[model samples]
Target: MDKFDKKILSSLHENARISYAELARRVNLSAPAIADRIEKLERTGVITGYHAQIDPTKAGLPILCMIELTVKHLDYYVVLERIRNMPQVLECASITGTSGLMMKVAVDTMPSLQTLIAQLMQFGDTKTSIIIDMPVPPRMPQLLADD
Candidate 1:
């Protein structure tokens, strides 16, 4: 990727909904060139997908929590599959720690959280922490001009 590609990526990261003409304006390229570059980026898997950022509180899932799960012996794949099917599970990761999986979850009520925890506990031990605040929220990485 050249400077134009990097600029295009940065512009898209800020606003994926931007029109071809607008993107071209920002990147100082023609609309057709912009479209061609974007298509290339997507085809090359550099551009994965576009998404809308939603506010969890307004979406009626006010409770945010982090769950650390210590999977039972030979249950890693099973636990991962189950977690993947759960709608409340926003994100899950395999990390280097005592816990095998860590997940960010959202729920409507305390009872719902308890129920989810109970379900996970059937597979292994669980440690849950209510997310009171997030000083730094999720954001895409910077695509430097030098990259």
Candidate 2:
């Protein structure tokens, strides 16, 4: 990607709903040119999908927790599949550490968290931590001009 593409991605990361015209103005490109570049970015998988950031508290899922799981056996994919199907599991990643997988979970109540933990325990041992606050929330990568 060139500088213009980098600028376009940076602008879109800030606001995905930005109009093509506005984006073109920011990147100093014609509206149609900007649209074509964006289309190419999406087709090449550089731009994945857009999402709306929601307040978990207002959405009735205030509790957020991180769970580190250690499987009993090496068949981690089996455990991953089970976790993937859970509605409460917001994100899960396989990491290189003591734990096989780490999951970010959101729930409505303490009882709900307990139930979810119980279900996860069926697959392996787990260490969970409640998220008190987010000093730095998740953000899209800052695509550099050099890249």
Candidate that would win on lDDT: 1
In model 2, pairs of residues that clash are: none
TM-score of 1: 0.93
Q: State the lDDT of candidate 2 residue by residue for 1-147, as single tens digits.
A: 899988998898889999999999999999999999999999999999998888887899999999998886766778888888999999999888888889999999999999999998888889999999999898777555583
TM values, all candidates: 0.93, 0.94
Q: Which stretches of candidate 2 lie above 4 Å from their native place?
A: none
Residue 17, candidate 1: alpha-carbon lDDT: 95
TM-score of 2: 0.94
Q: Tell me the tens digit of each residue's lDDT in model 1 across 12-103.
A: 88888999999999999999999999999999999999999887878999999999999986988988998999999999999888999999
Instruction: Identify the runs in model 1 with alpha carbons over 4 angstroms from their true place.
Output: 144-147
Task: Judge candidate 2 against the unseen true structure and give its global Cα lDDT, from 0 to 1.
Answer: 0.91
